[model samples]
Target: MAGTRRIVVIGAGGAGLAAALEAGRAGADVLLLEAAEQVGGATARAGGVVYASDTPVQKARGVQDSVDELINYYMTVSRHELEPRLLRASAEGTRQVIGWLEDLGITWNPDRLYIAGLEHKPRGHMPTGDTRGLGPAGGAMIVAALLTAVERADNVEIRTGTRCTSLLTGEDQVVVGVRTETGEEIPADAVILATGGFGAGTEMLRKYWPDAVRHGDWHWYLGPDTNIGDGVRMGLAAGGELRGRGGTLLETPNFGRLNDAFTPPWLIYVNKHGHRFVDETDTYCVMPHLIGRQPEGRCWAVFDDAALQKVADGGYVDPYGLGVDLESNWTAAMLRRQIEAGVVTSGATLAELAARTGIAAAGLEATAEQWNADVAGGRDTVFEKQGTLAPVSTAPFYAVELRPAIIGITFAGLRIDHEARVLDTAGRPIPGLFAGGEVVGGLDADVYAGGGTSIGNALVFGRTAARTATGGAA
Candidate 1:
């Protein structure tokens, strides 16, 4: 009891759970705290893809990816702004961390390869049988496995609905523990801040990430309700530096929760003036970046009955909206439900659809005519859209307005070092203070690589933080 070290993990998401498991397994007394009623934060709601280099799945499938390639891709995509040391650690340790998950009884689905925003290769590793519905099934599977492992660990204590309101620091401003909302104090030898970014915090978005909040009142969050920058606030109060607090991972936007579901490939995106912008088949990261350049961060998805029926006929759009045979993340049934809810408007004619969606009828009709011609000619003359072009002539026509929204974790939080230690404004590590996941920023810059990047960061750094906190091999 006297020699036992206490490790406190805040936010019981992927990072917190992984950190608690590793620390507890390493003979430390671990306390995993969550503000929610259960674990599985944004990770459960995510696509469940963890981008890793040199994974066993990659080897078995002959993926031919190397850490150098991964870093090159990361640097290229992130504009060489990602911290070099953190990037190297993540690239080198991803395969081993994935092995750790495998050793914990987590199974991989080797059938599918996801290459959304991740460039050049298929580095996404997912759990077996994780595809169930629109939500990420692999993420739920991973969380369930981690929860079971944590439950069986005698050294780990999980306390849900206990929000860490503040960080407690000792002499020299070294973090000692955390204080909960009800003024409950939980002391620890080391604290791991796994609490996610500020996607839901309007004030925090306004104060720190103004670009994320600049798009009128239309911008919204697709992350969990718990991601209100709790870790960022606590870290800032404890004098930790913030980084990458400018941009986020978003999509073609939505009207309230109308278009919050996955984007379909065949659906046409047009701006207010009813002109197609960007190739629809562009990657997820590219789509949002393209959409953000449009006037007022606005766009609209126009689809016809034929496109809808194509989905009804078993053709599927993958998680990143690429055409595939797998289940459509946004199903036809969901579309019908949205239609019934009036979030998606349908019309018997193009002009009627324009009237319903507030777009000019003349421009809408012209756009539809060009789209039909493009589909018939087997090429898009305007945007040069990839894949087989589909005509939107079949009625009734449907339209859904798009407003820029955060579809993933916010890209700003407490800054940390290569060892996962929270750093101060002076760039010095705060002793006994560490962070991981979305809470520890600088892994990304203006652009998001994809879904797996966030998951990979959480798993790799969460494990690293735990080992470092325990004074074990990192």
Candidate 2:
């Protein structure tokens, strides 16, 4: 422990930053290398929410959430495809992970918000107030906080714009350091790969995540353009096995497509066959799975004046409103813009709207009649869309087309053990090497918990990897 324990952390994303900060705090000499000009990979574009069970915020809110419940939720959501040991470690260490963040001067907002349509107790936490941590338009608050901690750590050295091209292996094929793109080898006693997933790599995404790639809808929302699965490839080359090829991918209405990638509100989501498939209020996690199950792996969101008024009334748009200019906007204005721009079509009557949208006019009329009747009768028949304060029967209806919009975070990657070590084909840990965050694929295989499983697990296992790398108790 007294000697210099050189640890090289590749990729200065959330997991890399968390790992470097934890290792440096543990008195290990750390060097954090980032390939891009700035840090905060996908986190820079994230909503800064972290899912943790039984956190201090939850306790303050009198919410009864235990580690057992957390583990149960994870296993149930993922259908036990994840390693039981890793889930146990993540659940058992949730409190410590949150405590560690607090100790590192990261503040968590106490106001607990329920994720759209998830059945879990409230465990969603974020930084307080209007200070959205980092990146564009106050979206990356957690990244900003974590970057501050990483910069202030005396034992940590951060180097940006330095791409790690290959792993430096020594005798017995153990990773000793990393080789940069410029051919400079940064030696280390241990290495941790947190370079994220291949969401941006069109070739890899098309090959692996074909559903997301086929529709040209995936890989639209992301921060780090350089996160092209370097870590995943490097780990596999070094004898790591991959998993989670089939995971969830969200297909929300691209309201932002009208506004230059800024998310919009008041769009009606429909499947490829021009019909509402699943509950629009479902969690983003399951939405992708639902969308993927649809024909052509695509969906659309129809909007009109009535729907816009509903959005303006502060209904289902609260979650996405923060990132886009939806409120203080008019549906007529959007319709005019879309019609002029040739992106959307409109009509004066429901029959005209049905003709333009290729939906059966009789079915559309029947659906609207039934929906309005249900609203009046207090029950829906077709989709069972409860709490319908408004119906889509207004004149001059508008419709904005939508495909699956993948927000960079892929639910797939390499398989790893509880110690954060990548597993081989035989399910054994790869010696002297470790991975966490999106690099470890099986953590959220079949399904994902709504709130912030990505960021939470990234922090959890980053710290765990640090402990394991330092030969300390994990």
Each model's lDDT comes to 0.78, 0.69
User: 11-80, model 2: which lDDT tens digit per residue?
Assistant: 8878888889888878899999988988888766666567778778778877888988888888887777
Worst 10 residues of 2 by lDDT: 257-266
Error of 1 at 264 (Å): 1.7
Off by over 4 Å in 2: 129-133, 136-139, 217-219, 252-267, 271-275, 295-298, 309-335, 377-388
lDDT of 1 by residue, 1-474 (tens): 899999999998889999999999899999999998878887766656778877778778777889988888889988888887888988987878777778777766555655646486778776653322424456766777677789999999999988889998999998999999999888999999999777888888888777776766657776678889899999888899889856554554343353233455587888877888877666655667778787766788888888777676442444533222344324687677678888888999989988877788888899999989988988888977666467989999998876556546677888888789999999999899999898888888877776578888898888889999999988
Q: Which one wins on TM-score?
A: 2
For model 1, give the RMSD to the true fold.
Answer: 3.6
Q: Against the true structure, what is every candidate's RMSD?
A: 3.6, 3.5
